[model samples]
Target: MGAEQIRRWESGALAHAVTDPFGQGPLPWLRGSEHYVDATGQVVPWYAEPDRDRGARGPRTADDVHRQIKGFAASGAVAPGQAIDFHITVDPPQQFSVDIYRIGHYAGAGAFKIITSPRLAGIVQPAPLAADRTVSCHHWWLSWRLQVPSHWAVGAHVAVLTTADGYRSHIPFTVRDDRPADLLLVLPDITWQAYNLYPEDGRTGASFYHAWDDNGRLLGERDAAVTVSFDRPYAGAGLPLHVGHAYDFIRWAERYGYDIAYADARDLHAGRVDATRYRGLVFPGHDEYWSVPMRRTVESARDQGTSLVFLSANSLYWQVELGPSPSGVPDRLLSCRKRRGPGKASLWREIDRAEQQLLGIQYAGQVPEPHPLVVRNAEHWLWEATGAGEGDELTGLVAGEADRYFPRTALPEHRRRILLAHSPYRDGSGALRHQETSLYRAPSGALVFASGTFAWSPALDRPGHVDSRIQRATANLLDRICKRD
Candidate 1:
């Protein structure tokens, strides 16, 4: 059957299938069997049909050995009635099709198929242009152009690319709308590009974090790219390294029917979004890269009574500058020299604008292993219904990177501040380190929350990592933020 035909058949079958209250489908990991009511009061199923073949081989590193097919969206996001381009490359050039899916909590199917493209001829695009520590594919041929349907809802979307032989990959983007919502979820597209080691063929791939030497030895930060372009596909399966963190939050938040709008981080940096229009702004992933305008706008929003939510650790750490692509598309190139260049290319803290001053807590250190999240200030409104008490420990809730309050740094002068979690974990060297989840109320009565650990969002929806306490606590925070004075 044709791709579109198959999509129709599966969708029809799902609509008639007995509803699974738990939302667990045949592929429990990828498909959900439950249903939930949306903000519009319509019942939606959370059922994402699993791909027969995802083409993902194992751990995807900077060096992606299985490069059957890959692609990238010309823009990280597009609004309804706008058109976006997909630049794709296929090894052993063959025909392929693109299937679009909107990622959400569709009654437990993690995603809902929106449309599918007919078979289109595919070919290998030109190689990347490397210069001055930057690898760019600004010259790649456009594989497809999608004029977004005006009826599509604003949310996180992905285009799945499948070759004739079934080699598949994905390209994630956001469908944004101008209409205001109670909460705005900003995807960290800038950080996604910062860590994208495209063409991860070992010889020429370069991201802001790392690159490979001529002899194929992985080089660290000192030798990494100072500038990274968004014109190339992401390494491995074409998904951003920490994208799942944001997806987890989206699924969990949507399941609860939160009135959330979506935007790309680039939209914030380019002055395309009015942050003050929303009651809250959420950064749902490892949003490490920031431009001057992005920081200033968010800070201004907070001062204007717009709350802020950082769901992951290590946020707003590296200060960057977004420039135009070689083709002059605005905000397509990200540059952060990270102490190697002059001006705003260093850490925000080095520029005397410590992240803690805005986030309530700044990056502390990496957690080599999962540790318990010890509850503090459990009586606070943020922990209202979680049944958590002081000194209660949530196992495996603190891992990956973490943040903590620094006494010496200039901090935000909030009317009230509280540390929600104060857990201690050993570092790689076995030295003791503490991670603190924090919340503070600004003079404008806007609340700023920092999860202080990368695992917080994943705990909300990721299988085997879901923690009911975290989910309830997050709901409490958002509910309070969305409430008007």
Candidate 2:
């Protein structure tokens, strides 16, 4: 927007505030992962990281501390079978017992218990929430270890630690496994923690995009936390991005009885999954942050015949590193500097390693409104049982941020790239743009498919938003990819 347009917007905002001081009037807002899809469709965009000179570095720590929870609670981020070295933080501290539960499919219906620890002893103290740390780091008065069961399913799990008085918080972890299978499903744990504004006070911590200053001014790139730990719980929706965008794919694939193994984003970074052993690797929703080792491992897997499927947009946009926490455990703190700074600056595209090279499409722009996912190549095998045809549109599928082919280079290098959907939409600014869904074969004969939209997986089961075509199309990809065909 031009200076004149920005001034007009500011004037309108001021006028609205004057008329409706309480903010009860109707107003629209732009939501989620939307950004510049420049005219050249640059693989690594100029705006991937905030411009170096754009924002000032705020004070390194908060002015005041948020010492809120005055009740009993326990929490930690330890893998299955590993000890949590749990902590109980409360004023005049209270004793509590811990009950661990595996969140996904269990014996009957919901979560199944893994372990129940003996009632632990503790005392509370004044632990100021650390701004740079992005957590209270409540010192454990009575440090106790709670171990997860080894036989439990390898997926998302939460240990709901509570006191007899009902004060509680859900500590989450992934029971990472190395078993080889037809498919390897990766959970985007790092991204969830990256965006979480746990305490929500803005003093202690916030995600990369929404950090605040002493005067409550929104800081840009400088606001990004260099180190974020997984010791605390996810606030509000409890993994909103994962649940809304990735969980459905797990349910759908499992319901259909596919042999799938699970790994956290950290597992990929650590080279835990022998990617070559699996026929396919599935990355569900909003996987924007990644490390260099992770990128190399996946690309190597792709070169060695492991089919790759990204059921989301904005795949591998930022480069990040996994470091240890106050505890010497790797992957405890996600480290990223989304700026042209001294450390490993996170935006991968800005460093010239464009995500388009991996996923075959670059994140184009955000389209706030719901629109059809129009079919371009109806006869493609991916559309096998979807009953979609040329010109047919899958209503309400093109979601917030979208991916499109740059059209300037051959991403797959050797095979014919199949463009499926050429759906168009009006961006948040009312500018015209489009999202593309595509599939192609790599030089190693490995297949690669991208949904080009973040909403693709969630649309599988969401009410009204659910589309059979989308589900069928996904099922088609899984069956073929898993078979290593």
Candidate 3:
């Protein structure tokens, strides 16, 4: 058998072996390869290296120094399923440790497979809570071997464990996988609205949560304590209140068959995307999070004829930084504003102003009103395309009047065809005026359709079918743009 294959079999079938060709085995090890032929002409074991391993441990050294793991290639690019080596070094003078822990989600939890030594994959992880590493030269080498899952969402956390003085220390290492800027769905780490308390402290800006039980179907509440929670404006109803928005958009978009990709704004700012790859971008659900670079990237792309679908509201408010964090969620410093309320100061006022002037939208304000009514904009092209009459339920996630949030004067002189003045016949705000959702558009074919009336998604929790006419219209609009020739 090859060295890679032998290592796999030995690691699995021959685990706990005290000593073998794989070296003094007994310490935990992780094997990335299935098999590799050895020089002895007999199938001998290969020591676990510090690259990426699933289930295994490291090879022990006598002098405590060796180059256990090293990089094979330096280029920041890879084709799917490409094979590469973890060029490792083991200095017998210094002790080294190799750890293999899943980053995104553990097995059977989510689709993506994350091995941190190289990098992370997927937006979340299963059992990616922690892993152990050894510190050497005052510099530790942490490696993870991961298999990229189909449709990976792109965000990661590492399980870090430091071994010294015969003791181990556990720490969480979070890393972002974004490398490009061009995408349609720039999804921020948004699980906070589903939690009882924001997972990280208010300082950590990651707003997302994920949990699963024995069966692994993403459990909502396992411990009876709060599994998830948000900062302010997200305390009540959780995501159930916004389930309608998710369901309706998915249903409509799927029906029309659009090429949609969900990405976080952090990725855009990092220049990880080749904007020429896709035609348009869509912001779905509560995309209230924003970073300065994210805003700049999107605006630049839009100006370059990349159609934008501002499906959600309260966007581009909080400017955040994307970097490493020793803690679970990383460092999040709020740099935006409240638009309303007492301490309200437009956080990234420039970005907000840019959106208003460019897209004809603004964060008018938020309200506590339920998704009671659906106002109509009969004259607008988006509405006219919907083929819906007046009195259609505008399923708003942050339901409020559209005109109140998106003012007409905000429209740039270039594009008036996209947005018609809110007919005075209605509340004169266009879509029911509200804070949570807003609407705006630019003349460059970029569009903003905010549903201020929140919860536009027909509620699955509701007894009868709710108003989904607007939902259908949204799907049609996206289909028209995304399907452009």
What count of clashes does model 2 give? 2
Q: Write the per-residue lDDT of candidate 3 for residues 313-400, one digit (tens) a residue.
A: 4555444444332333322222222232355343554434545553446455443343434445555545655555555443333333
Rank by lDDT (best first): 1, 2, 3
Residue 316 alpha-carbon offset, candidate 2, angstroms: 0.4
Candidate number of the best TM-score: 1
Ranking by TM-score: 1, 2, 3
Question: What does candidate 1's lDDT look like per residue over 402-424, in tens digits?
Answer: 89999999889799999999999
Model 2 lDDT vs. the true structure? 0.63
Across residues 1-485, which tens digit of lDDT does each residue of candidate 2 receive? 22112232222122222211212111001111124433344332211332225332211111112221222223323345765455545433466566666543332233456677787664555453565746635443545655656766676565545454434444555666677789888887777667654444434445554555665343444665666666554543123224445555665666677788878777778876788889999987778888888889999999998999998887888788777766574566677777636765466666777788888888887767767888998988889878899989888778767899987744656477788999998887898899999898998988899899867876764434567888888888888887634
Candidates 1 and 2 compared: the better one by TM-score is 1
**Candidate 3 segments whose C-alpha is farther than 4 A from its true place:** 1-145, 149-183, 190-248, 326-346, 350-354, 372-375, 379-381, 384-387, 391-410, 417-443, 457-466, 483-485
lDDT of each: 0.81, 0.63, 0.35
For model 3 the TM-score comes to 0.48
Off by over 4 Å in 2: 1-81, 88-92, 95-99, 105-144, 215-222, 237-243, 340-345
- Pitting candidate 2 against candidate 3, the one with the higher TM-score is 2
Steric clash pairs (candidate 2): 93-124, 319-346
